[model samples]
Target: MTAKFASLSCAAIIVAATHAFHPSALPSSSRRPATTTTTTTRLPMSFMADSSDYKADKSDFGDGADEDPDAAPAPLRGEVDMADVPVTEEIPVPMSRNNVGNRFLAVVLDGSFNKDDAKDAWEMHGDRIALTERHVMWARKQNLYNETFNLESRADVLWSHQLLSSDLQRAVGHAMCIDSPTIEDCREAISRDPIVRSLLGVDPETGMCDVSPVPLYRWRQIRDHTLRIDDGRDGLPNMVMAFDRPEAISDGLREEVSNDHLEYLIRSERVIAAGPLHVATPDKTDPRSIAIGTLLFFNAVDREDAIEFVENDPAARAGLYETMTVHRFNSLDVTGKFVSENLYFPGQNTYQMKEAMEHWGYPVDDLQTKWLNW
Candidate 1:
């Protein structure tokens, strides 16, 4: 399949008749002609060519003559000189969760970025679709997976609203793929990216940015899409999981917080509601009188006394309730109650919540802990 050719030099002026042979019509042996000549002076034996030389030249005929045996011959109108062409290699496009195969469902949980809850949710529901964060720094620190998580604040939605550009919002989601060490680390890393800071209009020197208030209706839409939950029994749609910002809850705002708020909090306690059990339907002596059970969390000083009252109360003694689940942690941070003087205003929180709200562009004036009442 391979051939080599060598150069020859001759000084004697001896010529022989040359004939071109049609490669297909001639036999292999006859394809190459034997060269013979008579000379007047004695010539060196080197002048007599060897059959090996001829064979080498014949083997290399196609290449030396600029012909390709493997390529199809062109039309008789013209002869085409064939040359080897080098092939080019293709670059690959990066794979992302959005473009991966469609065996998995993509769920965007609209909630506060609780690292532990996010991990648990992924384990529970992230079948094949890679889970990523909107937080760029978190992505880098965790270096946990090959995917990027988007951590764009409500600002993305606000921008979308102002500009009416779905494409811009989607692009922001796409750009969140940077790697990070941990969730906190990722936020820090993202904060350092100049492009991100510019897009969010964050000032590096002052650590401040101006953001627009999230339209209430739009926020609700985003929340619904992200926090879908499936209760584990009877295939009934009973509950949806979400990260609730106590600040966003408004009192008497039926449009925002429906009666379902109480139901959601109760369900969050992991209690099952009973059907049609009543304590008020009492005929004091009627055997049909039934008791009702309810769960409560108390932060009272006399805990034992409070429990006793519940146990001895007619409603409590009626077997309407079974037990109380109590959790006592160091009560730090603001509780959801409005103080008369409004000391715990919106802008007066610790770094985490304040920074988060500021990033989202919410007004910080006169905001009370009552704003968080659920």
Candidate 2:
């Protein structure tokens, strides 16, 4: 399972509160001057229905009636078949509870300490054990069902202070709503918001201050309801283990992984192991450092293949890992409700697309006039 960033609605109260109190805590105005506020943009009613009602056609643009003749063709819809794409090997789709009917169990580990110790903790945790069993069972069932399952693991150790600001949080939300170069840029924009800075208690001079603990770090690891399925097994891959403190992973080790290999693992189709690394340093105002290190898994044959690959690797075979354990987990309530909504993606045909673009400060005259007939 990949870690998901928080959604705008989940961070709205945090951003609002941060801006209200910590005016000086925002980023340096010298970097980018603050601007006047604008009215909130509302989406069109036609496209705002819940995801259950969503019925997208298999075309590049759903029902392409609203597409502009000159606009470039839209990209393919849904996930691409790995077989169809070029790669060193065939990437099998991940199977999980959402794909099949089996339940998913996750075990998160702390990756900041010794890899051996972290592994030990997961093994002792019964819940984690259960989760692993669930994954195996789900995978077996998928095989019987003539389906595929994908299992993967991950570690989340990248906790930048700049990204923690409430303004940045809100900007991320808005970015997902509109368009932005990167999530980091969206965060930078939010950092510029005076209101957001005030609320987060940012010290403008030093560009550092005690921001409210909104569990943003915690939320990031377990938001997003839709698990990234590698195949269509529904429940082939179903376990995850995230390791944190007291589990033996050290801060320094996790940082090394974060700065080196974690992000790549998060984006790959394998289970990840490592954790208890800190997101922030313990300080006077806020003593808690965001614990880094986590594991994400799916139920796919490829999962076992990846594990085999790791076990066969000289690095993993060298007994680098010391202790290991597992903890079973219930469902993670990550916030991706918006993405799951039918209105989540406003195609070129809808007025909602224009509204969203304009809201993001983009010039949407072409899209607006063409599709919305504005």
Provide the RMSD of all predictions against the true structure, rounded to 1 decimal: 39.9, 23.1
lDDT values for all models: 0.25, 0.29
Residues 50-168 of candidate 2: C-alpha lDDT, one tens digit per residue: 64553334343365677786995555675344456544442233322222111111111212112334333233233323343333222222222112211121111111111112222
TM-scores, all models, native as reference: 0.17, 0.24
Q: Which parts of model 1 are misplaced by more than 4 Å? A: 1-292, 295-299, 329-357, 360-374
lDDT of 1: 0.25
* Highest TM-score scorer: 2
Span of ten consecutive residues with least summed lDDT in model 1: 156-165
> Model 1: how large is the Cα RMSD against the reference?
39.9
| Model 2 lDDT, residue 361, Cα | 37
> 229-283, model 1: which lDDT tens digit per residue?
3222211111111211222222323223333434443344322221211122213
Residue 51's lDDT within candidate 2 is: 45
